[model samples]
Target: MRVCPKSTSSPLDEFLHHYMNGHDATVFIRGSRTPAKGTPAWIGALLSDLMVPVPFPSHSFDDVIKDFSLTDVDFTLPNLFAEPGSPEADPKVSGTIHVVAALPKQLNFDINVTNIRASANVSYQSHKFGELHLKKWHAANSTKVHDDVTGESDLEIYSRIKSAPLTITDSDVFSEVIQEVLFGNGDIILDADATVDVKVTTALDLPGDSLGKSLEPQISELRIIESSSAAITLSAVVNITNPAPYSASIPYINIHLLKNGSVLGNTTLRNVNITRGRNLNIPVSAIWAPEDAGLDARKTGVDLISGYLSSYNTTITAKLHPKSIPACPIIGQSLSNISINATVPRLSAPRDGHSPDNGSKTGRGKGEFIRDATFHLFTSTATFTLVSPLQYDTITLRSVNATAFWNHTEPVGEINYDYSFDAPPGASTTPRLPVDWSVGSVGYNELLGAMGGKLKLDARANITVAIGAYEETLWYVGRGIGATVRL
Candidate 1:
């Protein structure tokens, strides 16, 4: 039957219907779980399936009508008084479905109302069915389902998985209810037994946040891929899980990537929702920009370049606070202070590709410099100047080594230089090195590519630049093709 629940101030006149034998009905309750040692039941009104459109006034979930008895819903058997001299008997059946108890103001969750749903299935049966199969049915079904429990204690209720709807049994079971279901208020108050003390968690997804974070999720891998001095990428696997029996959501999430307690990058996730007892695995990919980290990594990124594994702390800190979808019960609500830390290896690998790992003894030698920017080599060590990638006013190039390559394989002789000169403040360019290299007849055409404005230097060098947490560190400078090669 269609139910029209208008505003309470304008309650409409209503009429109501008849019930038949062997018929079924459903009654739904919206509440919380609690430590009630007594039998549990869904407290509501039992309306007839054949009732006319009923007028239900809008009221709070706790708003329950009292002493309402559906008289026409008496057990009925049509054939009971049907034929003259007929051996068959379709007896009229009648029963009273009354709204007996008023639910407590607060709801509980410990009662596992869903578990109580099981018993509602086997509450009634026909006489023949009760005599022959009722015992077996009750024996089999009762073992698995919940019984119709009636007690005057507090109750807790949960909406569906995503707090979609609070569904109880259907017609034939309990019928029309004398209660209301309003926008849910997350969380139930269960004052039952000691079955509480359950674990509820909240997670936040911040910018640069990845999977495997302690508070937000678990992940398989998180790596930094070095492509060029100006281009880097970080990849991660993020998996969020909802361990509660009901569904939940993370209204806002941001996972920040920290480098030595400094903000490097971040991953932002908004309104993350998960199903009951399920997990959400997300493959996260983001670009790595030095400017995003508040420092000129191209300049200081050189310090992080190394062939040997250097230890730097890669931490995952998240802010997990999700609001309850006011329409659903609150079990797992906003969680805060989600922070995790893990030590990671910092190094720059070939542009082809690489992984995030603390490789065996990862450190660069004297001839190796991080391939962040191109350096011009002077044939003499009289005076040399080097530049960093970070956007800053003054840059200091401590030392560097350069070597030329041919055919992408053959390496020319290598050279080393050390200096302590500072470029004037606000100067965009570094001082040119007085030292020059003589490459007679090996023209500059082969050192450049026709595809783009990129120039190639067929040389590798191990240089030292001030970067990161270190003052001066060794970096491997490999086949860089950005600026002209002045050898």
Candidate 2:
């Protein structure tokens, strides 16, 4: 309280009491001598042995509110499961804490009092809440999470209070204590605050086999079947263990044949079933026609027949969806789609007991083939006698050039002819001319036995004859024979 020296009374002077308590007042006393006028009118007071017993009223949740049917606060280390210690030994916790002030007094600490009087300062602290800011407030975030148990929002709040009236109550008869506290009329409520760190992690649901061991699905027993010049059929068996604890079913299995990573053909297998921890085998096949191969079926067949002597690469990829669970969900299909690829390097065929295939020899298979590569070629000459009655003259001197072919398509390489005589156009009675030609290795092979093991080379000969100025030209196609006889 401050002392005003110059005393005067006015309604305007009442404003000075605005800053003072109701117990405070403005008192005026006359001085023995006249006080000095025009003083620097500052207010000050001095007193000795003067003390006011201001009831310091401040309250908070007791260490543990037993009367309110509450529980002992607890704290534990986050994520460090199975720690050895007394979680409730500590009076205050770092996580959520429920504070209950005794019954019937601002349950969640809401206090209302008017015509308020303040004679002192007040302060309080909740060590359980500490100074850390609140992170999650059940009441503020979700209405469903807030109930009578969650007294307030638990939002962070720090208040420095001063000059609030003190309410005095009987501590006992036995309840006079709240009467001596500040704004003591309110309900007792529970306020929960959690401070510990919370964490959540997610990963694949496939834990492991029933034995709790890891597993990898497998495919085996691959085979090639019914392979021929016209088409190739591949058959393979697939097997997999149901790693999960539940029965599994595969609705479909799609197998693709890939050559150097390109698709050749694909086949699907359906309705593959499996029991938990057991093997499931599925037989699958793919029939490849002429169109399925990058090369013609004949060549593809050759490669297969030759046991892939030169070694070509092929890979088989299996795509499937396995349900590790029975139809009852929560246990669902295999966690993800499954795919496996196995490479069959240099696919080879068996070579034992080999014989010529009907198509291989006859060239009449469902596929096209080039001519066979086995034959002999030879060239010889034969003479023809000219016997026309009108022209009985024989020419013994003449020259011949020839070319020949066998089977209308194969060229009988060249011609080598032998003659008995050589006659000039005007000369004596001798007939016929000699020519040379041949049959190539290819022709010989096709006609070795095909053309009666013999070849006939033919050519056209043009000759001009002169009988003392009566000159005329004669042209004829000539023929020669070659035998592919054994020595």
Candidate 3:
């Protein structure tokens, strides 16, 4: 029988002894203790000088590890009784004691040994079995490897350590580690909210009246009574709408009267007073004489006569007031209305001359001859009324009429005087009333024969009547009716 020695010293005994007795063991241990719990006196002084936070306390080895115990110790020596039946094994009775001890008496210690043995067997079964086993064991037991292993990796070990006789369970260790790792570096965080507003608008396009509307004149009647002249009058009402609410002033009304392509007259509003929403009455009258008629002479005479001849023409026109306001407001403002009425006068011409048998020389006297005449159906009055704000407005009136007349006269020698011839009568022994004188020849017959039957005369007359509020004028003419005759 063989007795195995029981080792009482721990596995860390050699390391602790070397740490205490080595030449630099004091310095090394001091360096190692630098990470121990509580502030180091010298390190604290240095941190105070730098004004930096002091490091927190660290745990000692005794505080970290506890309940260390050996569960079992086993030893085996081969060939203890191998030669019992052989000559070479005459009396070789070598034997070794085998003792199995519980390790640390922890709950997981059994599992740990089983796991280690399994890993070692697995490593040994691989190629270069010895080397692989040695490498695995060395890695598992290495101090650097043990230091690198986190408490998270030793969960089973920690769990078993809690059941050990001298082990302490650290409940806050993980939480403390997490806090230190997360807060090791300073952190910054920001919280914020945002808001915004938007606005929109729209524009509109509208229509307006810039260019004015055109104006058309309204006439009642037109007539040509003579060949070259006619008595014409225009009647029209010019209406204008304000189309606005405010008061608006009309400038003037332009009136143009044309006859046979000729501008008979042009008239403008000389007086106007137009109220808002009201109509104004204006009167208009005009007469045109033939171009051939002597208007100058007829205008000078008191009695003006005009006769209607053939091939005569006439026209009339009236214009509305133009826009007067510098600026026109919206529609429905004040506006104006105007109208005109006309009446044409009668025209006539007397016979040019008296017949030889009926009158004396130089044609019949003014009262002796019958005056031929033509009269217009309409009377001789024209009125124009304008309603607006303008102070001064003008209205024009014109008229034309033509006439022709014939005149006849006897010669001075046609009437012969009957005288008593004393000696001649006695000589003749018979008295006769102008003997050999044609019967009824001594009076107007002789005059007719002396004037070559009867004298002829021609006459023409043109009358123009221009009338206004303040003044009026007329034109006329006369002429012989036929060619002069000689006896």
Model 2 stretches with alpha carbons more than 4 Å out: 1-228, 234-236, 240-248, 274-280, 293-314, 319-340, 345-487
83: Cα error in model 1, Å: 68
Q: Against the true structure, whose TM-score is highest?
A: 1
Worst 10 residues of 1 by lDDT: 132-141
Q: What is the lDDT of residue 189 in candidate 1?
A: 20
Write down the lDDT of every candidate, Cα atoms only: 0.31, 0.30, 0.24
Off by over 4 Å in 1: 1-231, 238-254, 259-261, 268-281, 296-308, 311-314, 319-487
Task: Report lDDT (Cα) of residue 250, candidate 1.
Answer: 42
Writing each residue's lDDT as its tens digit, candidate 3 over 408-469 gives 22221111222322211000111211112123433334323434333333333232232222
- lDDT for model 1, please: 0.31
> What TM-scores do the predictions have?
0.28, 0.21, 0.17
lDDT of 1 by residue, 1-487 (tens): 3335653221111210100111222233333344245534332122222234433233243333222222222211112133422222111212222222233322221221221111112122220111101111111000111225754443232211111111222222211111100112333221111111111111111111110112245554555443344445656656654333333334433454544444445564444554544365666665544454555543343443343212232333332222212221111121222334533322222222221121213221211222222334433322222222222223345775665555455443345567744532221234444433334424233433322333444445565543222244455434433333444
